[model samples]
Target: MLPPIPVLADYGISPTHGFLPDVLPLTRLPDPYYNKWEAIAANLQALILSKRLRGVVDRLPVLDTIGLEHDAEWRRAYSLLSFMAHGYIWSGDSPSDRLPPSIAVPLLKISEHLEVPPVATYAAVCLWNFKPLFMDEDIDNLENLATLSTFTGAIDESWFYLVSVAMEARGAPIIPLMLTAIAAAREADAATVTRCLHTFAERLDDLTTLLQRMHESCDPKIFYDRIRPFLAGSKNMADAGLPHGVIYEDGSGKEEYRQYSGGSNAQSSLIQFFDIVLGIEHRPTGEKRGRPQEQGEGHAPAPKHNFLLEMRKYMPGPHARFLNHVQSVANIREFVEEHRDDRPLCIAYDACLAMLRALRDKHIAIVTRYIVLPSKEVRTRSRSRSPEAVRRKINLATASRQQPPGIALDTRGDGKKDSLKGTGGTALISFLKQARDETGEPAVEAWAHRFMSRVIRTEGQGDFFAGKPEEGAGLQVASQTEEAVIPGLAASWTVDDDVGGICYY
Candidate 1:
C-alpha cells in the first residue's frame, strides 16, 4: 500500500503556526537551576558588546539536561545555549576554537534531544527566538514581532531576523493548504487541486511582498558589518579563521573539531515545504543541468551532496522528517504534468513555480544589496587605505583579532574575488542564481519555461529574468544594480563559475 499522507500534527507542526512552535516559545526555562542559561541569553548583547561573553561562558558550570522537562523547555534551552554558543565563539577578537564544557556538554545533549545540530541554527536564532510585542496582537504582524536575542543589539539585527519570523508566520497557512493540494492530487480531483494551487500561488505572492519589506527596517550596512559576523558558521570559514572548525570540549580532556554551517534561511522548513509540495528538485550546487540520462549514464554521477538536502540536517528533527514524508507523497507536479491538456491546472501549477521563482529572484536582489554592495564597498575602501590603517580598523571592530567570518577584504583584480560564501558555506551568487533558475525548470507552460530560463542582460546592470520594463508589470525583473555590480553577472561569467552564494540569515 502507498504511505499515508503526512499530518502536520504528527511531526509537531502546527496548522496555525506552521513550523513555528504550536505554543508560544517559552520566555524562560521553568526550572530555576537553568537560570544561568537564561541570564546569559538575557544579557547576551551586553556580554558580547563588552567582549566578556566568552570569559563568562567559560566560567559557567556544566549544566545537566535533566531539568528540561517538556518540549518547549527543551526548545527554550536549545535557543538559549545556541545564542550563547555563537556569541561565545564570535564576540571575542578571534573566534573561539574551543567551546568549553559548560556550553558544549549540555548543548550536545539538548541538540540531540531536539534533533538539530549543536550549533546555532535557523530554528535557534529565528524560529524559537522571537516574542510578540503585544500580548493580544497577531504574531504574524511584522511590526508586532521582536527578536529575543541578538549579538549587536542593533535594530538592524532584529529587523534582519524578524523578517524571516514574519515570513514564517505569514506563510504558515500555506502549509495545510499545500498539504490539501497534495491530498487532492492523490485523489485526482482536478478542481480541488486547481483551487489549492491558485490559492498557493496567491499566498506565495504575499510571501514575496513580505520578503521585499526586508528593507523597510533592516539597513544593509549595519546588517553586513555588525550583524552578519555573529551568524557565521565554522565550515568553509578558513579565510576568516577556524580552519579546523570548532572543538566542543567535553571536560574529559578530550577534544574533537566539529564544523557546522551557520543559521540560514535555507534551514527554514517553510521554504523547503514549498519546493517539495511543488515537486521542485534542487541539484547539488554547480552540478550540470540536464534531463535524466538514458538507461546507462554512469550510475547517476554518484549522488553528490546537495546543499539544499544538507540544509535539512540543520532543521528541527521532526520538521526534517515531515519534509521527508512529504517528499514521498508529493504528486502535484506529476499530476499537472500528466494533465497538460487541462489549461487551468497547468496554469495554476506554473503560476506556483513563477511565484516561487520570483520569491528567489527577490532574495537574490536583497543579497545583492545587503552583501554584494557592502563587500564591494569594503574592497574599494581597503585599496585606498594603508595596511596599518586597515589593521587599526579591524582591531577596533574585532578587538585586535582577525577579520570576522563572512566579511573578508581582498583587493584582487577587478575586485571580483569569490570571498563571500553563504553562512551554509555555498558560493553566494552562483548558488542562488542556480537555485532560482532551477525553480523555473519544472514550469508546465512554455512561456514560463522560457521566461524563467532565459537570462537577459541590461545596460551595464547585470543579467536578469528576460522581460521588458513596464509599470506594474507582473513579471518585471527585480534586480537592483544601479550602483553595485552583481558578481558573476558579467558577460564573461560562465555556468561553471564558482562565484559564491551569500548567507541568507
Candidate 2:
C-alpha cells in the first residue's frame, strides 16, 4: 500500500517496521571493535587539527566488517564515518561543499548497506546511536538516552542529540497519518480526506507544542553558551568561537582537537518532512526569483543550491526518497480546490495549512533567539572593539580538561589565521538567516494568500463556490508580512515580495 513508505533495510533492526532504525543496545560494547573505531575517530580528529586530514583519510585502511557483525558495531561504523566525513568537509581552511572520494567512497558503501547517507546525519547523531535503558520500552520513557557514546563525549552533546530523539519519537505517528491520507486521496474519498486532514492538523499542532519543550531541560543559557558553540560549522564561524577547532578527548588523556561543524538541526528530517508535505518550495538563501517575464527565457533549469536541501544528501537514503515522494504528491490544496463544493474538505485542508504555517512561525522565533540575537550581539561588540577584546568576550575560557562532558574546548588564540571568510562564521546567525528566509512568509502565507487570491479572481461570478461556510464560520487564515530584518544585523536577507513573514533579528 502506497509503496510501503520506503525503508532502508540494512540500517534497521527490523526492516519491515517503516522508517524506524534500531537503537543502540543499552549495554557496553562486548568487544574491541567499537573501541578501535573510537581510536580511529580520535586519530582522525588529530590529523584534522594538524591540517593533515586529507593525507591520513586518503590512507585510511579500507573499511573491513570482520568485527562489525553486531548492532553496536554497526552503530560505531556509522559514528566513525560521520566523524571522518565532517572532518573532511568542514575541517578545511574553508568549508568544502563537496564530499571527497576519500570520505565519500567507504561512507557511501557502508551507508548504503546501513540505509543511511555517506555524511553526518540525524540518524548518525541520534537515531542509530542512542540506547534506552529498557530495551522493550521507547526511548521517550527514559530520562537519559545518552548511555551509548558520543563524538565529543560531552553531556551537552548528548543533550543536543537527545532533544532530536525525543522530537522524532513525538512525530513518529505522522508517518502513518500522512501515508493513510495518500491512500484516501488515491480513491477520491472526500470524507476520508476530510478526516485525515483534521487528524494531520492535530498532529502538526502536537508537534509544534512538543517543539516548545526544547526549553524544558535543554536550558537556553547552556545551549547558547555551551552546546550551540559545539554545533557551529567552520563555514562562517571565525568570530563566534572555536576559530581553529575543538579538541576532542579520547578518555586516555590523549586529547585531540580538530576543526568540525558538529551536529545541527540543519540535518533534521522531521523539519524537512514538513516542508515536503506542505508544498513549501524553498530556494537557496540570497538567490532571488526571476521576474514572470524572465521565468522561461532560456528554459534552462534554474540552478538550485539550497543548503537545507543539500543537507538531505546526509539523510538515510530511503528517508530522503520518502521526502521526495511526499513532495511529488503534495495534492491537499489541489484536492480541496477540486472539491470546492465540499465545505468539510476545504475547512479541514485550510486548518492543516494553518498548522503548518504556525510551525514555521515557531521555527522563525527559535532562529531569532538561537542565531540572530547572539550573532548580532557578537558582531556588534567585535566591530566596536579590538580583536583581543572581542575574543575575550566570546571566548571566556572555561577550564580545559575540567569542562563538563559534551562541552567543546575553546580552540581560539592558537596564532592560527582563520582561512574561512564571511560573517556567518562568527555565530549561528548565517545558518539561521538562511533557515529563516527559507521558512518565512512565503510558506506561512500559502493558504491565506492563495484562497483570497482565488476569491478575488472569481469576483462578480455568482456562487463561485458551490458551498459556503456556516454564517460567521470559515477558515481562520493567518496574516503574512514583508520580511523585516532585525536592525544592524549584517545578514544578507532577501524578502520575497509575494510572501509576508517576519524573521526577527
Candidate 3:
C-alpha cells in the first residue's frame, strides 16, 4: 500500500476529511486578549479611514494585550499584526519593507506560536481570520467566510481569501491521488498510473472551473484599488511609489527597508503543492544580466532567486518540506513519456497539461479585464489632460460603498474608467504578468514536446526514487533532476523590461 498519505493536519484543515465548522477552531481566544485584539483592530481601522495609518502603527503596544498563548490568541494577534503591518507598510505614498518592533516583534512571536510565517501570509489573512456564519456550517461557502479584519472591509478581500479556502477544500483529495500515483509508478503498474493520471486531469479541470468563479462576486475595480493594496509587499514595487522606503513611526528615527515581496497567490502553499506534485517547472519572469549559470544536477538550471520561488521560504516548515518531497517523487511525466507507445497514457498526460494551461489562460483573461483594461483606461484618461494634471487617487472614504453584486467589471472595448491604476503606479501589471507568464503557452508547449517526442530506448533500470522513504518500503519511484528543481523548456523571463518608469510625486 502507498505510504499513508502524509498527515495534512498541520495545515489547519485536514486533507483527509470534510471541513466541519467545529472540526477546526479557527476563531479568536476568549477573555481579555480577545477584546484586546478587537480594540486593536478598531483602532487600526480608524487610522486607515483617516489616512493617518502611516508612521503611527509603531505606537500601538499590540503584543502587550496577549493574555494567553493559545492558538486562538495567536490567531487574534496575527489578525491584528496583519492589519497594522499592511497599514504601516502600504498606507503611505509608498510601501515599507522594515517593520517596526511594535508590529514586527509581536508578529514574529505570534507567528512562531501559530507555526506560520511572520509576514502577512495566507495563514495570517485567510486561514486564521475566517469564521463560519453558523457554528455548525462548513467554511467552504463564500458567505460563511466572515473575515475578522482590521483594514477596509470589502468583498474583494473576502473573495480573494475565500478562493484559497475553496481551493484548499476542493484540492484536499488530490493529495491522496498524487500519493497513489507515486505508488503506482513505483510498482511500474502502467495501467494504474494511467488511471491516476486521468483522475488527476479531471480534478485539475474542476479546479480551473472553480477558479473562473472569482469574477462571480469579486468586482475588478474594488479588487484592484482597495483589496490589492493590502496584499502588496515592498519588493519590486518601486513603480507603486517607494523608490527608497517609508520611515517607521518608532522614535529611533532610522531609515528601514527590507527587500520582501508581499502576499499573493504566488505565496499560496496549496498551489505550490500542486506545482511540486505535477513536476511543473516555473522559470523566472524577470530578466537576468549574465549568461545562464552552469547546469546543476539532472540538467536543471542553477537555482536563481525568483520572487515566486523565494516565497517558499515563507511557507510553514512542514508544508514546505511536503512540497520538497512531492517534487522528489515527481514521475508522471517521465512515466508517461517512457510509455509513449501507449497512446492512452500520452493522451491523458497531454490532457492534464491542457487543463493546467487553460487555468493560466483563464487567469490571463481575468487580468486583461480586471487589471490591464482598467489600467489602460486610466492611462488614456491621464494622457488626455495636461502634463501637470494630477493623477486620480483611491478614495478610501468611498471604499465601503458596495458595487453591484455578481457583476464583473465591464470588459467592453469602450474606454471607460475602472479605477485600477495604470502600469506606472500599481504593481498589479507586473504581478499579473508574472503569474500569466508562469502559465503561458510556452511552458505547456515544452511539456507537449516531452510528451509527444520519441522516448529514449535505453534498456537500463535506474534508481528512480531519489532517497529512501521512512516507511522502509524501498519502492523506487522515478528520479527527478534534483530535490526541487523542475526544469522548463525554452521560455523567456522578460517579455519586455523597458515598459515604464517609477511613478513618484
Candidate 4:
C-alpha cells in the first residue's frame, strides 16, 4: 500500500481516485486503454489532429493562458513527454516500435514497475516542484486530467506552469539529471539492446542492477501528492519557508538576497528544503563536518558521523540518508582549501565554492517560497498573476533591478533582430565574463538574471524539450512551467561520496 497522504484532505483532493472534473464527459473510451498505454496514444494523436480538438483548445483560454513562451528548458521538458507520447502512439501500429516481451519484462524490474523514467520523473517534478507554482492558475484542467482524451491543449498546459515553479525552486539543478539519464537511456536502449541474446541478457542484467535501487524507494506519489507542490515563493509558501532570511536592499524595496554567495553553502536555507531530513546546521564544524564535500551536502567534507544523522528520524529515510551522504563529502570550501591555499587564487576558489553553494541555496529557498509553498495555498488566492509580478519580484531582488544593457528576453530568436536574439545561454556566459572582470560584490539582478538564464543543458540533441513549451522555449523558463531533472539523487542519506548534492546550497 502507498504511504498515508499528508495534505490531500486539507486541500480536498483524493489520491486514490480519478483526477477528473466536476463536469462529466459525454463519452468514455473502452476501459483497458484508459488504464494502459497503447490505446491512449492512438486517442491522443487522433484527438490532436482533429479540428474539434483544436477548436476546443482555442476556446479554452484557461488551458492555454500558461503557454510555454520564452523558455528553452520548458520546450525540452515537453519534448521528452512528446517522445514518450510518440512511443505510446506508434508502438501498437508499428511492430518495430513495440518492445520485445523480454525487454518489457526486465524494464519492469529496472524501473521498479513504473516504466521508463517517465511516470516517476513526471510525478516527482510535477508534484514536488511544479504544482505549487501553478496551484492557483485556474488549473481546473489538471484536476480534470481524465478528460484529456478529449481536451486539446498542449499536453503541457495542465502541468507545465507548475513545473516551471519547481524547476526554479531547485535552481534548475534537476534538469541536467533528466538530460543525462534520458539521453543515456535513449542512446543506449537501442545500442545496448542489439538483437543478440547475450546482448539481451546483458541488458537484463544491467536492468537487474538498476532494480537494486527500487528497495530504496517508497512511492513517487509521496512527493507528488504531499510534500512537493507546496513549496512556493510567497509569504504563505514560506509559512515555515524563509525567503528574506538573507535580505538585500535595492532602493526599490528590500529584497530577498539573490546574489550567488558561493556554491552550495551549508548555511543557506536552500539546503534545508529537506532540513528535517538532512539535519543541516548553521554551524561550521559539527557532526556533519567529518565527511568530505559532496554535491548537495555542505561543501566541507565530513570527517566522521554526527548526531545529525539521528535527526534523520524527522525526515523521510531517503532524504535523511541522502543528506548524510552529501554531508560526507560536499564541502566546497574545504575541498578547494585542501586543493589550494586558502588565500585568493584568481577567482578565489573558496569564493567560487561559496558562490556555488549560495546559488544552490538561494535557488532552493526561492523555489520553495515561490513555487511549493504557494501551491499549497492555491485555494485561498486565485487571482491571475500579471507579467509584471515576477519581473518585479526579480527586479526587487536584483541589486540593481535595472535591465541588462542590451539583454531583453523579448528579442530572443524572434527574428526581429538578426542577432542571435534570444539565446539565454549565450547571454549568461557574456555576463559571467563581465563579472569576472568587475571583481566587485556582484549585482543581485545581474547574477540572478544570469544564473536563472543558465540554460538547462545536456550533451545529446541539446535540451530534449527544446521547441517544446513545457521544458522552456529559450532560456527564461517561468517557474510555473518546467522542471530541471537532477539525476542520481540519493533518496536515502547513507553517507556515501559520489552521491547527489545534498541539502546544502
Candidate 5:
C-alpha cells in the first residue's frame, strides 16, 4: 500500500513554478473578487459554526471557543487574509492598498506570538514595516524608486536598510545612521547588543500580526521555531543555513559569529532565493544531468524551506488533518493553554500564527499542482496508489530534493507555447465572474476545468515565454523572457515584473 500522501500530491509544485509556495483558493469567491471574499467569509464562519469545529489547541486559554465561530471581527480578518493571499486586489490601475487598517488591527494582535522584543521587530519591519514607505511607487515605471526610509529612531529598528547601505553604494544614511545609533546606544549604556533571538522577538509582532490576519495559514510546528525565529533574525538561514547576522548598534555580535552573512559562507543559497518556477530542474528517469544547484555550495545539504513542517511540535492530530482546512488562526487563550510553559508565549504565538499564514501558502501549492505541476507529468488522472509508480513518484521527489536542484527538464510538454492564455489568468477571472453570477456551487465548479484551461492559456502567457503556438495550440509568442524558463514569466510576475498578464483595455 502507498503511504497516505493523498494531500501531499495535492500541493501543486514543480520546476515550472520553482520554489513558489502554493496559493490559497478563494477562487470559489464571488465576483468583484473582494465581494466574493466577503461572501466566503460569511460562509466560512457558517461552516465553522455548522461543524462546531475545534482548533488543534482546544485547551489553550487565550481561545474562547464559545463565540469564535460567529465572531464578526474574526471573520473580517479572515476575509482580508484571504484577500492578501487569494483575492486579486489589483484593479489594474496602481498597486492596491494591501495593508488596510482592518489588516493592521489583527496583524498587531497576532504578532504577540511571533518574535521577541527588539530583534523580530527588525524582521517584521524589514519585511512589512516598510510597506507604507514603499507601496506608492509608480508601478508605471521601475526607475521611480521611492526613498527607502521614512522613520525616526536608530538603525536598531530597520536592519535591512543598514544591510542595503553596506551593500548598495547609492543608498545613504544607512551606514552613517548605524554609526550614529551605535554611538547613542553606547552612551546610554543600553544593551543595544543582543542575540539574534532578541532580534527575532522584535519582529514577532509583525509575524504574529500577519498570522492573526491569516488566522492560521500555517501548521503550528513551522510557525514557531523556523518561520518566526528566522523572521526575527535571531536564527540564521544557516539554521536553515543562513548566510550571516547583522551587527547591533552597540557593536555586539549576536553570535560570536554568524554564517552566510559575512563569513566565507555568506550570501549562500540559504539566504539567496532560488526561484523554482517556469521549468523545474530535475533528474531524468535513468541518469542525472544538470540540476539547479542546492541552496549552498558543493557539499552542503539542500535546505528545507517549508516552515510549517517545523511547527508540528505544538499541534494535536486527526486534528492535523481537520485543521488543515482551517486558517482563521488560533485564539490566544487556546495557544496559552496548549503548549503550556514548555515554550515562551511569544514564540508559541509565532508558531501558531505561522500555521495560520501557511493555509494561504498551501493554497498556492495546490494551484501549482493543478496548473503547473501537470506541465511536468502531463497526465489527467491522478495516480493515488500503485507501489511501483508511487516509488517512481517518491524517487523523483526524493531525487528532486536529494540531488541539488538540477536544471533538469521533464520532456512531457503539452507542446503548447507558454502564453497568457496558457497561464489561465483571464480564464480564472472569467470563471470567478461566471460562477459568481450564476450562483449554486454545483454549476460553478462543474465547468471549472474548462474555465481554468481557457484562463491559464489566455492570461498566463506573454513575457514568461515568447514563442509561436504550434498551428492550433493558441500560443503566439510575441517575446521570450530572457530570464530562463524555470523562473517563467508568470512565475516571476510580481508587482514589479512587467508580464503580469492583465489586459487593461
Candidate 6:
C-alpha cells in the first residue's frame, strides 16, 4: 500500500489556514523583557524615515530568548526582529555588512527554533505579520486583513503582504482536497478524483483572481521604488554594496559572513503544495527540457539545483516537512496518466494545470507593471540627471542605490537593459516564464498539451510550433528571445522594450 498521505495536524498545518499560523499571530509578546525588540518594530517606520534605526539598534543590549514561552511568542519575536534587522541593514547610506548581537543573537535562536534563516522570509513578512481588522470577519477577505509590521508603513506595503495572506487563507482547502484525491487515486476511484480536481481548479481560479486584485489597493510605483528595496536579501547583492553577506555578530568576537535569499513568494508553501499535488516539476534556471539521463551516455547526470526546492529551506520547519511528506505520496498525475481513457478525469486534471498557468501569467503581468516598468523609469530619470544629482539621492532607503544583481542602470551596447535577478537570487523574468511553461508539462490530453505548450506569437507572426518542442531547441530559443513567450500567451513588444527587473509577491 502507498504510505499514508501526511496528516495536516501532525505537521502543525491547519485545515482552515494552510501554512499560516494555526493560531492567530500574537499582536504583542506577553513577556515584557523583549520590549526593546517590540519597540524597535513599533517605531521601525519612523526610525527608518529619520535614519536612526541603525544607531538605536547598535546601542541595544542583547536579549535572551528565554522569555519567549510559546510558539506564538517565538513567532512574534521572529517577526519583530526580522523587521528590525532588515530595516537596520538597509536604513543607512549603504547596506550594513555587520549585524549587532542585540538583534542577531536572539534572531538566530528564534530562526533555529523555526528552522528558517535569520533574515526576513515570506513567512516573516506575510504568514506571521498579518491580523484581521475585526475578530468576527473572515481573515481571507482582503478588506478585513491588515499587516502587523512593514518597513515603510505604507498601505501599498500592507496591501502587498495581505494579498498573500488572503491567498494562503483562500487556498487552505486545497491541502485536504488534494490529499483526498491522492487517497481516491489509491483506491482507483476516478469519480472522486475527478471531483477533487474540479474543485482544485476552481480554487486555483479564485487564487488567480486574488492575485490580479493586487492593483486594487497597491500602487505599482510605490511598490517598486519604496517597498521593494527593503525586501532584498544579501545574497547576489554584491552590486548593492555588501560584497560579503551580513556578518551576524554574536559577541563571540569571531563572526562569519552569512548569505541568504530575501523574502520571496517562491518560499510560500501554498504554491509549492499546488505544484506537488499536481506533479509539476521545475528544473533549475536556464535548464532545457529533457530527461537528466539524456545529458550523458549510459549514465545518469547529477541533478541540477531546482530553485523551488531550494525555497523550501526558507519555509517554516513543519511546513517544509509537510511538503516532503506530500511529495512522497502524490499520485494524482500518475493516476490521471493511467486513466486517460476516462475523459472527465483527464479534463479535470488538465483544468487544474490550465488555471495554474493562468495564475502565473497574471503574476508575470504584475511583475511587468510593478518591477519592469518602474525600473525603466528609474533608469531614464537617472540618465537625465547629473552625476552629483544622482549621488545626492543614494541613501539607504533609496531604491536606485541597490538595483538587484545583474541589473545595471546603464544600457549595454545593444541598448538593452541587463537582465534582472529576483530577491531570491534567480534570473527574474526567465525563471518565471520557465516555471509557467513547466506547468503545462503534465497535461493529460494531447490537445491540452499542445494548447498549453504552444509558443505565443505577435499578431502578425506565424505559429512558432504546434506542440512540445524537441528537448533542446524551441523552448530554449524562445527563452533567449527579447520578448520571451509565456506559453499560450501572445507577445506585443519590440526588441527595444527588453528591460528586466525583480519581484517578490
After superposition, the stretches of candidate 1 with alpha carbons farther than 4 Å from their true spots are: 293-304, 392-425, 460-505
lDDT per residue, candidate 3, 158-250, as tens digits?
776776666666666777777677677767788887787788778778777777788887786676566666665544344444444334334
Sorted on TM-score, best first, the list reads 6, 1, 3, 2, 4, 5
**Per-residue C-alpha lDDT of model 6 across residues 34-148, encoded as one tens digit per residue:** 8888888899999999999999998999999988888899999999999999888877767788999889999999999989899889999999999998999888899999999
Candidate 1 residue 61 Cα shift, in angstroms, is 1.4
Computed on alpha carbons, the lDDT of every model, listed in order, comes to 0.75, 0.49, 0.53, 0.26, 0.24, 0.78
The parts of candidate 6 lying over 4 Å away from their true place are: 291-304, 393-425, 462-505
Pick out the ten consecutive residues of candidate 2 with the lowest summed lDDT: 395-404
The TM-scores, one per candidate, come to 0.85, 0.61, 0.69, 0.24, 0.20, 0.87
- Record all residue pairs in model 6 with backbone atoms less than 3 Å apart, i.e. clashing: none
Error of 2 at 6 (Å): 5.3
Query: RMSD to the native, candidate 3?
Result: 14.8
**Model 5 CA deviation exceeding 4 Å by range:** 1-114, 117-454, 459-479, 484-505
Question: What root-mean-square deviation over C-alphas does model 4 reach?
Answer: 23.0
| CA lDDT for candidate 6 | 0.78
Candidate 2 local lDDT, 410-476, one digit each (tens): 2358843222212322222344444444432232235555642231222222355645545433323
- How big is the positional error of residue 338 in model 4, measured in Å on the Cα after superposition? 4.2
A best-first ranking of the candidates according to their lDDT comes to 6, 1, 3, 2, 4, 5
Better of 4 and 5 by lDDT: 4
Question: What is the lDDT, from 0 to 100, of the residue 400 in candidate 5?
Answer: 17
- Model 4's number of clashes is 116
Model 3 score (lDDT) = 0.53
